[model samples]
Target: MSRSLVIAPQWIGDAVMTQPLLRRLHARGERLTVGAVPWVAPVYRAMPQVEQVLEFPFQHGGLQWGARRRLGRELHGRFDTAYVLPNSLKSALLPFLASIPRRVGYLGEARVGLLTHRLKNPQDKPPMVAFYSALSGEREGLEQDRPVLRLDAREIDAALAAQGLRRGGYLVFAPGAEYGSSKRWPVEHYAALAASLQQPVLLLGSGKDTPVCEAIAAAAPNCRNLAGHTSLAQAFALIAAARAVVSNDSGLMHVAAAFGVPQVALFGSSSPLHTPPLNDAARVVWLKDDPGYQPPLDCAPCFARECPLGHHRCLRDVRPERVAGLVQGAVSSA
Candidate 1:
């Protein structure tokens, strides 16, 4: 049997987008193992096709030379091929050190010698999922088709009960973006949108987003904050059960897309074309020219730790009513 190991992306959204590649690999009849961070392990564990999951030690800080060497020794003789999804130079080092014969990944950072099969990134890849699917040797071209994520039925049921959600339909909103406040929509705006939802609003995010979710929930009594409560798998299950999801351009938005849930993804600083949600049912809302708004002087979208402009107009300018309208339309259509 052909044994293969695939290194998963660290971010939850990137991992969700890489599912098509995972499914493609599974169809090839290879014994598959996934290497992922502890936080994202729950998400991969839910994937039926994945046979094994190896955790990267937190002590390594992701690039500890000794840790990489030790992991390599343990992984030796385990797999014939390895596919790395992340572009970091360190990501390639683990499997390379493990001495996996065939290493596949995008031609990034001039690691041509390290990867045995390097595929050039596709041109004009609109949806992020299409770009990831191209990396799988089994898939020939960019598949513009909507991405799909399957969850265990039991888990979905448990998620619904945990959130008190029902089939009558509900909205899921994520107002946090881990990168920085620049990527996050205003909290008050999310509260306004939640109050307008036709059904109960389910708020989702990590521990960092607790404050935002709490404020939104307080403003809209019908809203429930599930931030810091659900595991990654539970988050996916919840998104799958929702009629629609309204979110800032973050990982949960990607999860909403993967589950084919209708979504309105608010974007600021980040370009929608580069990383739009991968669901056909989703639409991206970005700010256009407004006379009062001045262009961010310090190279906005620098993907920085903080917004250089004291005022985060990129996200602040997007009105709550507009987002609510989109949510209404998405849920109505569904």
Candidate 2:
């Protein structure tokens, strides 16, 4: 049996998108091992197709040479092929140092020699789902191939109980984006949406989102801010059991899609064409492209950390009423 090692992406959305590639590898009868950060490791662990998950302890953008060398030694000769996913030069160091004979990856950051079979990044930059899936050489079922995860029912129940929540009792809202505030919808809009839905809203995100979540909870009755309170595993369970999820273009949005949960995904600054949710159950509303949206075409998809122009109309113009309408439709159908 052949064994493969995959260097997982750092972002949750990217990690989730990689599932299709993993599935493709599994279909080829390869046993898979994934290297991922602590926060994103749960995703790989939840995949039944994955045989092992190795934790990458280095901080983001930090290159710890000694630690990487030691880890490389430990992983030496364990895999027949290693698919390096991240574009940074450091991302290839472990697999290269481990002496994995066949390393495949995109030619990134002058990493020409590190990978034996280097794939060129397409000029068009297709949707991330398609982009990652193509790396495995099976690109035909792009739309039909959704990220699938097996959640423990008991664990889901426990997560709900811990949050004083019950299955189908609330709407899940993820309002934070690690990318930047430009990608986040206004708190007022989220509050308005919560009030309109009449269902309790459970705000989900990392601890960084707590203040904003708390503000929204305060503005809307029956809303609870659980940001930073739950582990990634618990967050997955909560999202799996949600009545419906209304989320920004963030990692949890992809998590909701993985469960095939009905969701209203809000997008701004970033184009849905690049990193859209893969499941049919998701309704993506890209504000800049929506009807009645009149922002300068150039201003959109800046993909900037913060709007350089300082006017975040891409997100602000997408009214709560529009989002609420979508959520209501999704919930009713669900």
Model 2, clash count?
0
> Which candidate tops TM-score?
2
lDDT of 1: 0.79
* Cα lDDT tens digits for candidate 1, 167-201: 43677898899888888888888888777764788
The global Cα lDDT (0 to 1) of model 2 is 0.88
Backbone atom clashes (below 3 Å) for every candidate: 0, 0
How far is 295's C-alpha from truth in model 2 (Å)?
A: 5.6
lDDT of 2 by residue, 76-173 (tens): 98999998888889999999999999898888899998999888888875788777777786658876667887787998999988878889888899
TM values, all candidates: 0.87, 0.96
Q: How close is candidate 1 to the true structure, as a TM-score?
A: 0.87
